[model samples]
Target: MSAARHPWWYDAVVYQVYVRSFADGLPTGEGKGDGIGDLPGITSRLPYLRDLGVDALWITPFYTSPQKDHGYDVADYRDVDPLFGTLADLDVLLETAHGLGLRVIVDLVPNHTSDQHAWFRAALAAGPGSPERARYLFRPGRGKDGAKPPNNWDSIFGGPAWTRVPDGEWYLHLFDTSQPDLDWRNPEVGDMFEEVLRFWLDRGVDGFRVDVAHGLYKEATLRDQVRPKKPKKSAESMVERVLNDEPMWDQPEVHEVYRRWRKVLDSYPGDRMAVAEAWTQTAASMAMFVRPDELHQAFNFGWLGTPWSAEAFADVITDSIAAVSAAASAPTWVLSNHDVERHPTRYGGGPVGLARGRAATLAMLALPGSAYLYQGEELGLEQVDVPPEARQDPSWFRTGQPGRDGCRVPLPWAGDAAPYGFGGPDGTQPWIPQPDDWAALTVAAQEADPASTLAFYRRALAARREVFAGADEETVASAEGDLLVVRRAGVTVVLNAGTTPVALPQGEVLISSAAVPGGLLPPDTAAWVR
Candidate 1:
């Protein structure tokens, strides 16, 4: 990590905001409605972000998109969509975030672009022989069968990875057919992506959260991916097709590209950082993206898919810390994002299970690394049930998978309102319907209740701010056993995984997840002290 890179990130707590479902500024009259949550709408919520003690905000891709994969399928890099507001709106957001002392990191999907993008469109219009087509990875059909694709690599959405272009040859799409993967092996492709980075950096944006960082490259030989033994019809199968398990990730060339980008970032002030999304299960593989010449940090997905257990979480966290130590960079933890089910849903749903979810949040923050908290997670929001007819994600539609619609529901801001204050002023219908229970746990309701999860998070975040204020990786200390304990600076965090209260060394209690008198911590509760 260069001293010139994003310093705000080292001791920061990042709040991941999924714009489409966060807060819709516009509303339609129908009971079931769809409207855009423009940049202005996000701007209006800066106060809420500040109150949450978030030093940084990581918004999912908001570039011009086709909505195929929410905003993951970017159609244009430079232009801002009319539905989501314009370039000027982004300028305002950056200014507002910086004014509030929050560093803004936008999602950058450099691995691919929506097939609807002008480059892809021109490639199709110019035919396979055109030089413009070479910008993307295109391969000819197999043998004499001109229609069949070159290889059988499956798409993350489903079906074949190769999409037959409107012309002759087929182009590679690691994800949905609408999203064609870029050819990172090509020098021009590298240059093109670098230009995109400069565009955002020039806009005064702090940094980027690289989407599918590992998928940027692939095996030079278009080999068939090893399919799962018992191929079930679930999202995991799609992942088996094309994800971090591939040999393409952490490719030598990818490191060179990152090194170049890191140098570019070093030229800026306040220090910029790039957080890579590596979807591997083990922390060992994750470290590759955060080495001295690679990404500043990579998503530690070990906890994301693991079963809910304190012991298991301890192992994952310990392994992640070891991985970061080996790479000379700290790890990053993400409980939930647009791609996975919310933590509240994953670790047993409903109010009774909230302690488990909060325990996970506390565990992540207590560790010595950059932590990512998904939007609405602080409110202990559960996943929304999406009817089949209401599903829009291509992954779900084409693959018949449940997809991530459950976790990407609209946020609940007002105490009692339609779509939970995610819609326009009257709280009308939003782009996605809020969960039935959202109104009860809405932000307004929680804001007024001291016992609500929102308040707990405020206290927890305040604690984090105090502990991490002047701390570093070396300042973090750990204690082993069923109850995982971490101490940073003067703050000691102890999480009780068992059902009974446990004794702690004599010290004043800074905060507790449960109202356990004295030093004992209730089941699934956490406590912090000096």
Candidate 2:
């Protein structure tokens, strides 16, 4: 964060685009005619995002995939999927986004590839002991006939982690069966990934968001994962259960992979960087991914999961700053992403939730580091309750889990009915249906309302750019019951997380998450003061 060495991303606000649900370019449904979001749709939305005040865009995978886990399972690294659009469409997106003053970051799913990827297909046809099979994790099952899986590990999406082949070998897929894990122990895998990095960099993409950044390597022994005894009636918090320091994620060897990737990024111009999606046991553990020689940033999930309380926020923020700063890297924060329920829904799912979400964002933007804004968050969109039959996330079909379709529902760009302004004026049904209530949250509607959530975000981001973006340190001005306050550069951020109001300090209020009545920060409200 030093003046001479500071990178553009150090204080940037990045927007995450879950491409398939973001927008649809082809009014006629480009490839599959499925009406899914595509590169063209993104290109058209560039000006809107640039105007929204984000410094960069982190676009999720749209690579050649079977769509089993949406785009996380890659069938081909070098080409675009037909269901999304074409390579030409992608080039147009990159060119347009760059022209709009946006840095585009695509996703890199190194943990696994689609079962249909050439390497995996060749591996299957190469039989049990062939070199092609060595590129992936293929282990012999247990028992005399090898009918049982090799270990007790389970997939992140649920069910057994290993899937059997007709050739009598069980392949590891920490996610879904369609995405077989690659063997990072093999030099070929690393070399190929390096080439993939160069291909996109050469194509002018800003960087990559490394998926499951902690999961490229597993324990060498491939030992059975240790398990804690089942608790009585779901006592463990969702935050604790997520990632869980599980055997499948956050391995020490993963750091080496990122160190190499950092070198690749550094070789390129325009201050290219990579942000890791690494879920670790604590903020301290998460910081390992962003060491100077490794990635530029690691998502601070421990901070993201902290309860809506003054105490929880203070403790998590302290640990996040200390650990990340120790690594000489800035902390990256996020509230909602494609994989999680929208924050408004998580906060409490009504007027209270929306208020809390806005306050939380103001506090996040007040912090002295980079932050990620999930698409639709600016409009205060909540997770839709997708019906079972309409659900598309593989996790739902595989494990009967609620799945992520609720958050991945197609965006409501405009219009008051189905499809919104997503595809085009002559749009068809969306991939995942948008709820009826989203008409009130469309960008067009909010753009005209000063009190709208969208307007609130725009103002907050502008104020940050003007007041807080350059500051690299924060000191706690106050952290008492129902209130937390932090000072950065001369600005004070006050958050009232408890019921009732807390009197604000005597200073000119720069911006407030909501209307502050009688100079008091109301419950679930946050404000920045000069």
lDDT of each: 0.77, 0.88
User: Backbone clashes per model, in order?
Assistant: 4, 0
Question: TM-score of each candidate?
Answer: 0.91, 0.96
Displacement of residue 527 (Cα, Å) in model 2 is: 0.6
Off by over 4 Å in 2: 1-5, 27-34, 230-245
lDDT assessment of candidate 1: 0.77
> Given candidate 1, what's the lDDT at residue 227?
50
Tens digit of per-residue lDDT, candidate 2, span 23-89 = 8875453443356888888888999999999999998999998889899999999899887788889
Question: Which candidate leads in TM-score?
Answer: 2
Candidate 2 backbone collisions, by pair: none
**Stretches of model 1 off by over 4 angstroms after superposition:** 1-6, 26-34, 166-168, 227-248, 473-481
Worst 10-residue stretch by lDDT in candidate 2? 26-35
> lDDT, candidate 1, residue 435?
61
